[model samples]
Target: MDHWDEVRMFLAVAEGGTVRAAAEALKVNHATIIRGVGRLEEKLNTKLFEKLATGYRLTDAGSDIVELAGQMATASSQIEARIFGRDQDVSGPLRFTLPISFATDLLMPTLTAFRANYPDIALEILSSGSVVNLGNREADVALRVVVGGASPPENLYGTELCEFHMGFYIARDLACSRSLTPAWLLGANEAVPTDWAPDAGIKMASVPIRFAEMRSQLEAVRAGMGISALPCFLGDADPLLARVPGGPVTHIGDIWLLTHGDTRRTKRVRLLCDDIRSAMQGFAGRLAGRFEGGASEFL
Candidate 1:
């Protein structure tokens, strides 16, 4: 049996979660997929998956195999690229992952220009709230918002993109009708203020509405549900929401461009990173507010 072919079948089954799905993805018959899996299990002398009514489920051993298989696939792709000199065209699949909100509000607008400049490069944007594993090569690049003293993995390389200032924003009507006092806006929790400024002396008459996502928080504020502290890039763009006067200002977070340390020097990786950094720098005013600070530290 061909080991590589068996490995590919294992990966397909692991990804698709069923022999039928794997067969479809591989453009082979289901029997072929089942035989491939059986051959792999016979060679390894261990059951990778358990047959179930719903679908095949990976055993603990299978889970471990999947992780290793993903890494192997990445290495294989890199080897193929090297042999073919695929990087010479600067146009190919560029998979990237970023925070959902950042991708929608910040990056989506400027992606057209990036594509135009490098028409050969096909961009794949994965907007996930969860952190992607760089070591596994889940994504070629990632954009992360980090706080002070945070360190990335030793296998990862990161560059400071920009800093965003945060402040409270409320609907125009809410600002007008309510006292708009910090004390009234902030409820009992001073550690994290809701609609009012954390430092504001006014006490809240009732609990302000809370939202888990930034986009929802912004929407709630727009709907006049309550005030919310948001980054300038997202908040300032909305016409209905206004940055409250005399509001306490805070550091939202620093945006960083990240890639695997080993792949950072790769031609495609470096070019994409440079292009994204340049785009972020150009939009510094709109996204991060006007802050006077050198690129040395988190502003």
Candidate 2:
């Protein structure tokens, strides 16, 4: 294997903590990852990882090497971003990231329009649950939710699309099932105000049904699992879901269409940003939860 490929394999393994995960991330077979890491360890003449039952734990030496490798990756990404930033043409690869739900629920039509207008841009939409660090060139552009009015990273520049809020929601049938005790269906981020359930004017259960992701949480709610704080666009639009009255409408965050400062001027990126901003204006009402909604009988 080439020198950088060896380093890349070792870096992937270190980041993923498991050979299978590294293989999946790199789109290579498990044997390839094992072989590359083995070759790297052989050349370095030291054991980089301690193979544990749980996963590969980095040795002290491995940690040091990983830090250097991370720096190398960052520098390489910066160089690539800078070169791509200077491109003036519309025809080129453009990768962007956003929440999978947001992409499907709110931005699909707008994204379709952008694709229609700029077919040569080679647009790539990355919604996989990955650390989409613009600094690392994981994606060239991003639709990020900056919570609590926080600013985007110093290295990023773009405009705020708008803020979307969440509402307490329950399935219509479940709400009608008066015998069933009320409960919370938690999504990925579990940090929530303790008083939210009480504020809903319902005697909710103390324990929540936890989900690894919001998508499954949404499905659980639809299947009459319990109440959950769902985005207004999602809960309001679903026929089987109904808003629970007497709860605070929590602001998730302002959605921002940002790009690394180095690549902000790239033709395709700028055009796509423009398209999103323009399209967002048309969706301001829906995104901000202007739909006429009926409340579920939660009390």
Candidate 3:
């Protein structure tokens, strides 16, 4: 039995509390995990865990081992990074995270172009609203929307990508009615379309026809439910949805690219960032309308 592998199994068991959970994390069989733990105990000549009906609990010695194991894991990761970092070619998996809406719209096409340019680089993208932890190695890069100037950790680097443009949109049928003014659109009598708009002021006044996700919100609008405030990308893509003629345009947020300071210097990361920055230049018109004036101030 490999001592390091056994140590890793032991650490996983300690962190996960159950052999079943550890096995799942390690992508190994349950019996394999149990055997690994047994071998680790035999090598150390001490019982590290107390088996229970539900799971396992660490002994006094196990607690000490867990801390050491954590350090070892960190060291191993650092070594692996260093080894990969030495290669001049941009190879290996690059984990990226971004907001779900942005991923589907702004970043997807650009990412496709990047992959075409660098076939050697494997990309793993996680489209989620939840922020990923860079320090913990959860993601190599992240894109976020910030209302104010963002201050990432000193060990991390960030660059402003673009400003997100937003405005009220309604179905062509609703626009034809000529009663879709900002005051009336979200009024008590008017039907509110479910988008990311805040439920205050006009939003509070109206009765929401449906509260839904991005795709559904656009669908609802196309179905002529009501008016909704949406990002420019979504509105521009749909011919059925028309931007309110003269309404309060909002600056939903600024898009930023964030990466660990150490990773920023890497060729793969630098290349990808440069590509994204270059692609975002085409969105100047949309960004300008959102930021050049007090667009988001109404909210």
lDDT for residue 151 in candidate 1, whole number 0-100 = 46
The top-ranked prediction according to lDDT is 2
Model 3: colliding residue pairs? none
Candidate 2 lDDT score at position 35: 83
Go through the candidates in order and give the C-alpha RMSD of each one to the true structure. Answer: 13.4, 12.5, 12.4
Give per-model TM-scores.
0.59, 0.65, 0.57
Candidate lDDT (C-alpha), each: 0.70, 0.78, 0.70
Candidate 2 lDDT over 126-147, as tens digits, reads: 9865559998888998887788
- Lowest lDDT sum, 10 consecutive residues, model 2, at 192-201
Clashing pairs in 2: none
Clashing residue pairs, candidate 1? 91-120, 183-201, 183-202, 183-203, 184-202, 184-203, 195-227
Model 2 stretches with alpha carbons more than 4 Å out = 1-86, 129-131, 188-193, 196-203, 293-299
lDDT of 3 by residue, 1-299 (tens): 24877898899999999998996676555777888889889998999999999899999999987998998888877886887568558877888888787778767899998899899899898998678998788888887777655444434567766777767776765556545533223322334443445333333334354443566666676777766666776775666776665455677677777787457667788788787677666765655453232222222
Pick by TM-score: 1 or 2, better one = 2
Between candidates 1 and 2, the one scoring higher on lDDT is: 2
> lDDT-based ranking, best first?
2, 3, 1
